[model samples]
Target: VFALVFAVSCENSNVKEEPKKEEFRPLIVRKDGQYIEYYPGHKQIKMKGREDADGNRAGIWKLFSQDGVELSITVYTKGKKDGHIVVRYPNGMPNYVGEYVMDERVGEWKFYAETGELLETIVYDEPTKENK
Candidate 1:
């Protein structure tokens, strides 16, 4: 049959498959030296961060909105979130400022309105420290 003939010809010719111009890529993937990643089905960047050779997140990472606006900035130490953190509203104004101690929120955390007005303040008890 024609199908059998075509299969035999392809095997003997060693024809390679052609690749498409636009290949599909995942929105989020963990790979060494990958510093930028997009959200699902979005063209704009969703997060920006760097990974060590061991595939651990290091240093600072930025999260973005679908509109490509920065929504949060978090610091990482040896793959753990630590240090200061900031989250913003859709308007790009800061929504909150807080600190992370060894991946846990601690100390005073201040929240703000979209208009840069302070809404509330919260103090998280340090989990590592005994409550007085």
Candidate 2:
């Protein structure tokens, strides 16, 4: 009887356990005529912006860090980057500011130090058709 009980316990110990499933929730929603997306578990907002009728990113979009801090602001037209873009450090200081034309960087781009001082500026020339 002791041998039989020992064998049963060993068999049970060898049994495989199923993996746990991760929880996921929908992120996108429509609020006040705008479409917004939230982070998993609804802990914080991930992005808020407008989407075209075809569900493409349009107008201005703001993305946030996992901690709910604004990370970047970008303007999109038909899912393509256009207009001005600003990216910030995790500490909420501006890291860079630049403009885009049809997904191509244009004009002058400004970089900032962590102290919010201007670091450097770069000028981007228009791309030629051959190089584009």
Candidate 3:
């Protein structure tokens, strides 16, 4: 009964709201070549550490091709790639997905073709005498 009443009240509420949009605050560069490529057709692209008001890069950053196909999706923790980074083919199909440690491949990395077929798997392991 309370739920029904609350639902009706919510439907009649006159609250104007805006959908949350991803924010892209440009980083100020003191040196040359320090800007993230946030759009497609961006040649000679370079990226610098993005920061928040408190100076943190805890946001989503993407790269694209000239045809507007998403090339990569990388998330940063304190300005380093500390999460899943996805790379796609120019045709927009997934090319690779894996874990990264400070932008270095650290775990299982899977590669796929433009048609979504598995292409390969890469595992990082130190060379052992027996395996060598």
Candidate with top lDDT is: 2
Instruction: Order candidates by lDDT, high to low.
Output: 2, 1, 3
What is the per-residue lDDT of model 1 for residues 1-132, given as tens digits with 9 covering 90 to 100?
A: 999999999898997778868768877766566678887775798998988777777888999999988999998887877889999999999999988777777889899999999999989876343233
Q: Number of clashes in model 3? A: 1
Residue clash pairs of candidate 1? none
| TM agreement with the true structure for every prediction | 0.67, 0.69, 0.50
| Model 2: residues with Cα > 4 Å off, grouped in runs | 1-25, 30-33, 127-132
Residue runs of model 1 more than 4 Å from their true location after superposition: 1-21, 29-32, 40-42, 125-132
Clashing pairs in 3: 52-56
Q: Give me the candidate number with maximum TM-score.
A: 2
Clashes of each: 0, 0, 1
Which scores greater on TM-score, model 2 or model 3? 2
Ranking by TM-score: 2, 1, 3
Query: Candidate 3: where is the Cα deviation over 4 Å?
Result: 1-50, 53-57, 125-132
lDDT, candidate 2, equals 0.87
Q: How do the residues 1-132 of candidate 2 rate in per-residue lDDT, one tens digit apiece?
A: 999999999999999999989776678888554887888788899989998887777899999999988999999998888889999998899999999887888888999998899999988888322144
